[model samples]
Target: MALDSNENSDKSIHKFESMLKTDDVYFFDAEDFEDIIHHYLNNGKVSLGKKAIQFGLQQHPHSVELKLLHVEVLVFEDKFEEAGKWLDELQNIDSHNEEIYVQRANIQSKLDNHKKAVELLQQALELTDDSFDIHSLLGMEYLFMDDYEKAKLSFMRCVEFDDRDYASLYNVVYCFEFMEDYDGAIRYLNDYLERNPYCEVAWHQLGKMYFSKQMYQEALAAFDFAIISDDSFLGAYFEKGKVLEKLGKYREAIDCYETTIEIDDPTSHAFLRIGKCHEELGNDDLAKYYFYNTVHEDPLLDKGWLAITEFYFRKKQYKKALHYINKAINIDGENARYWKKCAEIYSALKNFDEADFAYKQTVDLGNFELDTWKNWVTVLQKTADFNTAEQVLLQAIEFYPEEAILYYQLTLVYLASDKPHEARKKLKSSMELNAEMVTHFKTDLMKYNRFSWITAIFADDKKASA
Candidate 1:
């Protein structure tokens, strides 16, 4: 009975061994094992790969390939400390082995020691006469190190060894771009296109390099090819739109921006460009609607608020402009432009106290523009805070000593505050800058000089505080 059982077990083992070897066909259990590994790798299931590797070892004990793959799986799992143990075991068994060195390099690359990875790959290069993969890996390591010159050299070697590799050609082109060799980048990419006509990244990068060099038409053509190759290439479409914008093709630019917005809603720049394109095409309502949509999509985006604020400002809608600009300030209170816009709107609305506060906020944010200084003086003077107004005017004069408006403004503040003696000192400064200051001031203020709206408040001291 024991012998019969032993014979049956032996037959079953023989059948299993036969099944493991592929007989003139690729169908085998080993193929299933590789599929599992690939699935684990693609899904980032490092633990499962590790467990699978252990189970696979029981079936195929002498597979050095599997052992090597297990190390890769450990590294992918971010179990670098554990991967080190496998490396030590591999080193002891196969010291000076080229493949072991490459595996170690891959492990080191995962740990971000790219320089060490490159040095290890160089050693592997000495062992193999025709090693395109070793060179490609070296290029990838150098790219990670930001050594674009070395990366380009290594990637060029990979192309020479295996020009069929599209990624290798693309890597060399990217290195040229990173090194700022626009001509070299274009030349290599063009050569690559002649060999592999469907390289999408090369097409996109060629467009980007040409755009950077101010070759707009060539950029458009390259982007055309890139978008044709991958219809969902949002970045390529965006570049195409920007090139069209620079070439004064507003309608085509709008189409490209709209296309990109359809694919990529998270891009704040796309919405902004589309809104500007609509504005350029004399579509104010469409522009305003898209600007509002951008704000709805990303409430935290400063550009969205700026766009909406500018929309209202352009329409002379001071209150709406103030609302959006104030929302912008609330989102990011330190922004100088929002504070300035709010101050301008409040001044236009005759909200003098709020205008003073807004101008002071702009000043606090270090905005020292000439007009910003002028606005500050106007708001302070309107508030009957002539003391602060004089201080602000002097600061403006310090920066713009020859500005006729600063001296004239100081004179206005003094004359308005019932201090003609202080007004006389400012009058001399005004006279030095302007032979016609009094005429211009009187002429400009004549429209609003009907001080019924302005003087009603200054008629009482507590009026300003109110």
Candidate 2:
């Protein structure tokens, strides 16, 4: 009868430890040494693994497996040149060994030679009946090459061989997601579930796939199954909460989020979700409490900070909003959204100079949204920085060459700068692009309406159109 692997490993490990304490020699066969070394390496006890390898080779110097284990340890320690030399020596002794090819592939992969690694793995696959590990390695190589289709196939083969291979299953889903093959992913997961029905990880993954497709009910059912399989699965509860929120079940969503907190530590993300749910339910006090909890739990969470800033902004609490937004900016100064928010809050308080600086920061950080440019220009005009306003509008026009509003705004800036020629030129361009938008700035244009040149241009355009 075959020895139980756990029992055998336990006896070998105990014997090895006992021998280490004394100066006595232990008689461990090549396989026992392999398991012992594997145990140390897998558990991240590298020094002990090296010791075990040295002792193992001393006992069985000609054992190819022991030599390979030494090579593995060398690779782990990043002694690539040494490992390669050792592998070459082993290959000469046992060229038919699949492990030689696999270890060579590992070295190639570490060096980022993914294509060469794939070739080596293919050779290993040819030599070995157990292709599961080789397929997993092949999938990773294909992923490194960004060949999602091949990666998906490789990982799927791993899943077929062992349905419990959640890591390979995750890679399969990731490939499908990268390719945006949601239906195919759903189909594959559904088939996987039929064989391994109670796999919480697979069910969690299925829920996310369905959620991506906006199939909320299907997502909810999958998440519920995940929770039923493993009630301690925090991810399922969090996702279930999100699904409930999408379905407008605020109370139920809160319950799910609270369940995650019960299962594990309260995450900033969970607190944020609960806050959003309370906000949806019109429980403003409860929302504010959770929003505070979110930032307190994780001060670095930008989303949590933004939520609090927006909450106060909605209540017209401009000072409070400004305070929280400034805090967010202090945490992530490069965040364009936070800078934009700061600019808007400053503009609301009529702090035009501060607002202008914030707006500049927002643009500098690469936020080229139309409203950002428009709002920044408006702030410049408010501060009577006609020179800078004209410059700002001109820059905005480049990004929005066809946008009539920018041309109209530029016309105003030019008129304010006492450059009627430039103003008329931009006014005509604006009319040409969108004459109807002229109504939006009619009140401002009325100030310059008394100018004969402006009146004449409008008259000529109207006559030409008629």
Candidate 3:
């Protein structure tokens, strides 16, 4: 039976508000003042927090905790000098107090002296018998410095003192991720589970680490334990479903996803995944229904619109694909992938001008791949925009100098513009990069007389062998 601190805090707030309404002399202990002020601060009502501290100080003038909180309020208001003065006075009153050291460390952190803050917190850790908060603060300072290994050790110390410190535990896992030591994370979580086997969150985190490493079976087992520890944990179900999907267990994955929807409200992600699973299982109608449900659940989810668009495109419903992609673009016009998709759909429908515009937008948004540049150049050639195609190839060669295919394609553009010297130069560079792609180049371009330069290279290769 833990204390219902929230209920107590609510009552305290109500009584304080009533006292304010009636102008009555309300009495509250230092702890009550702390809670009331903390409630306001946590809710972003900093003004109200300051008022609480001011009013509480009127009654308990000698309350050191209230004075410390007053310093915090001053700090929050960006009154750093006042906060420092108050901290100095408080240290004189209680030189050995951990809270004073913590406050000073916070001020140092705000001043961008994280190294100084770490030293201050380390001193505080020595002064305190229960150093959970000190360890947590030190870990945050180390994290700010990008010393992930030290940050992880500090958070591990915090978790050792208090296994219920879920935030510190999560930070420990985050530090592991920052270090890219997934094996270390798995070992740490396994050790933590040995101590507190019923901690569902730790199990869930373990599952996530395994999933990242692509150990799908191990991830599935971890998620199963998470669900067993807390049957109502929707995250475990969702994660397990993802692992099942990776394992190609589509029916099992669908069941897990369905269970998540049953235990919690429907999510756009869940609905979309369900649709994908149904599609894999060869149930197009059910897949369509779930895809529709996905957008209905969250109209603003770009993924849902993208999924619906892909579904229509696969079915060769070009008009419907175009409609859905337009809807997606309208929602997130800056999304490069959406523009790229739109370009592909338009190209399939032979809407050359629209496809060219979409491909241009894709490039402008920095969402283009090598294929996008190739497609754009192809469209330009189809529309007899040879000058623009040459310009595009010139720019593309600068970005993709290592790609033999780009140089090969550039040779064609230069030959078309009657720059035979430049064409031969580009052809020589292309052969040097990848002589194997000569077959592909020949198959695509051998019809034109300009392609004679490419054949001359092959002739030279054969002569060298002879």
Tell me, by lDDT, which candidate is best: 2
lDDT tens digits, residues 1-466, model 3?
0112466799999888788789687899888988888888887888888889899999899899889889887776678899899989998999998888888888888888999999899888778798877888899999999999999999999999989999999999999998899999999999999999999999999999999999998999999999999999999999999999989899999999999999989999999999999999989999999999999999888889889999999999989999999998888899888898898898999888888899899999995488989989888777767788888888887788898988888877877777788878888898899988977877555555455666665676679889
The candidate, 1 or 2, that scores higher on TM-score is: 2
Model 2 Cα displacement at 19 (Å)? 3.9
Better of 1 and 2 by lDDT: 2
The per-model lDDT (C-alpha) reads: 0.78, 0.91, 0.88
Off by over 4 Å in 1: 1-32, 110-112, 129-133, 157-171, 198-200, 227-235, 259-270, 298-302, 313-322, 325-466
Q: Of models 2 and 3, which has the larger lDDT?
A: 2
RMSD per model, one decimal = 12.2, 3.9, 3.4
lDDT string for model 2 (28-139, tens) is: 9999988888888877788888888899999999999889889887776778899999999998998999989988898899999999999999999999898888898899
Backbone collisions counted per model: 0, 0, 0
State the local distance difference test value for candidate 2: 0.91
Clashing pairs in 1: none
The best-first sequence of candidates by lDDT reads 2, 3, 1
Clashing pairs in 3: none
* Model 3 misplacement above 4 A: 1-14, 43-45, 91-95, 107-116, 386-400, 445-453, 460-466
Poorest lDDT segment (10 consecutive residues) of candidate 1: 1-10
